[model samples]
Target: MNTIYRLLLVTLFFVSQNNQAQKRIALFNQKDLKGWYAFGEEKGKTNNADELFSVENNMIRMFGPKAGYLMSEQSFRNFELTVEYRWNTDVNVVRKNNNKNSGVMYLVPAETPDILWPKGIQFQIKEGATGDFVFLQETTLNINGTKTTPGKSVVSKRFADAEKPIGEWNQLVIISKNGVITQKLNGKTVNQGTESSVTEGRILLQYEGFPIDFRKVNIKKSK
Candidate 1:
């Protein structure tokens, strides 16, 4: 009887642990852009506007004239986000001269201005600058144990260059919990900060006058 009781208790504990570990949400449905909405200069103009944000070959492709972003309809907090992205070889005519630029913006407040860019912390995605941090609209962060207060756009360089070559997919892992945020690129920890002004909000993928492809936007509550 004693042995049976001990086995039962062990089984229950494993079941509880598995349940907590399996709490994950797929932000992008591979078939289509079901839970996302586009915002930019060309939004709501015509049916063709949707073409800017479309699912092609099981990846979300952003290619169009205007510069804007696709925002998640839901907000999240205290989670770990994983996504893969690659730069498209075709750049828009207007932005061809400049290096490609895109980003994953998170912790946007509810009252942030509805403009080309919102008030949030951005994981800077650019040519040779992946994993850099950008604080938009006076947002604040504590970097390397020091608090930063740039009046407008504050940029923090990543600790190392971990981006793969152009056209190859790179993985990004962003973990935000208890006001602390850490960014990882290609499985390397590149940047981390604490005491972020905004703890929770929607996620935004930027369309900074360049073409990009994204896949597997997955999130799960941090254990």
Candidate 2:
């Protein structure tokens, strides 16, 4: 190849690789709630009250005496996110007659008002259903080639129950690109969808009347 043509080809190759490369970010610094905010369903933003959430020993502990969520202050798009979580038995959910329920909500538009459940797509982390895609607040996600309309959600048919036994950490990874998204548990891709209505927004870690522990909140995105 000619010298000039060789240089042009090398430049194009580097540019393509850079666009495909992902930039890593540590969402949770593990020392304190630096880049996050806490919102309560009843009172709106509490900035993570003492009784609602706490950070210690490189872990975030959520005490769900009520309904609220620890939300990321910044928005993201076309990224892969990973978080480790486990149900905290410190709070007896059965004694309170509540199912062990919590979730990771993403694509929450900044303009949307924060309520009991904000507008986003939720990776449902229930006892039986771990990888279900819940379109919250009329948010739509097309799964299995079918598009969801307002007030709809898609239960992952192939969503394997990869939830580790209670008290054991479960790794959850979510990838959102363009309009497509995938939900994974452990190392398995449990659910995926395309054509999300909300393309970019902030993320939320829910405290839905249940105690949960989280660690290693991180994300990688294309530049």
**In lDDT terms, how accurate is model 1?**
0.84
Error of 1 at 137 (Å): 1.2
- Candidate 2 minimal-lDDT segment of 10 residues: 90-99
Model 2 stretches with alpha carbons more than 4 Å out: 1-21, 48-51, 91-97, 152-158
What's the lDDT for all of these models? 0.84, 0.83
TM-score per candidate, chains pooled: 0.85, 0.86
**Highest TM-score among the candidates is held by which one?**
2
What is the C-alpha lDDT profile of model 2 across 1-223, one tens digit per residue? 6999999999999987886566578999999988898887666887654445789789998874567888899999888999999988874532222678889999999988878688898999888888888887788878788887688454445456688898899999999999899899999999998999999999899887767889999999864
Q: How many backbone clashes does candidate 1 have?
A: 0
